[model samples]
Target: MKRAEVLVALGLLVVALVVLSQAIHLGPGWGEDGPRAGFFPFWLAVVLGVSSLWVLVQALRAPGGAGARPFFPVGGRRLVLTVFLPMAGAIALLEVVGFYIASLIYLVIYIRLTGRQGWPLTLAVGVLFPLITFFIFERWFLILLPKGLFGERLLPF
Candidate 1:
């Protein structure tokens, strides 16, 4: 358990560090009017990285030796695969259909299948969430998001 915990902590630390670096590159500083796009996330990444480092240190300094058990127990495979496959598909779809459409489809499928929700709520979330996101990010913030091939054909503005 100790070894596994240490390894996981190390992995998290590395990931947090990478995110922090990217966030810094994205412009972590505040502007004249307000914070830059990356400022909040950059600080969050810093906190995450520091916390991960602390976890790693604790894991390494623990008194007992590493545990014998495996990271994932039996029957965990299905759960892992269920989430992994959808996320992988969504990432692939991101390039093809862009974030909004891909996210809409992903949310609908996940909610309908895994959550076992009714049509009304599922449809509402599937449609409205991305639509609201489009308005908030594109229209209000003026942050032009990635519009894939279909967006070129369908969306005029």
Candidate 2:
């Protein structure tokens, strides 16, 4: 578990670094009117990097972390798949349903089915995210996102 944790953290660190590198080109600073193109993504990368670093630290601190241990525990593959498959489905749904709705559905499934969270937390996460994202990106930044099948009729934004 420790070894696996370290490897996963390292992988996330690499990804975060790569994202941060690309985001720098996109511009991470604030512009005259609002945030630059890369502002959010860059910060996201930073958070990912920080969290990964923390996981790496924990893994390294664990006893015999460097010792031989199978990368995946017995049920690790199932856990990975459980999380991954929904994300894959969400990605597919994004094109058909657009970002907000697709993400909401994905969050609902992930929070409720996978996380086994209560309705309050599930609904809060599922609903608030899209609403906040819409306001932040669409209203504040005046950036238009994809309007899929249900977007035109159902959504006012």
Candidate number achieving the greatest lDDT relative to the actual structure: 2
Clashes of each: 1, 0
- Please give the CA lDDT of all the candidate structures: 0.85, 0.89
Worst 10 residues of 2 by lDDT: 64-73
Q: Each candidate: RMSD to true structure?
A: 8.8, 10.8
- Estimate, for each residue in 56-109, the C-alpha lDDT of model 2 and write its tens digit: 998898787356576677799899999889989988888787889998999998
lDDT of 1 by residue, 1-157 (tens): 7778898998988888888888888889988898888898898888888998999898788765345565567778788988999999988887788878888999999999978999999999999998999999988998977777775555666
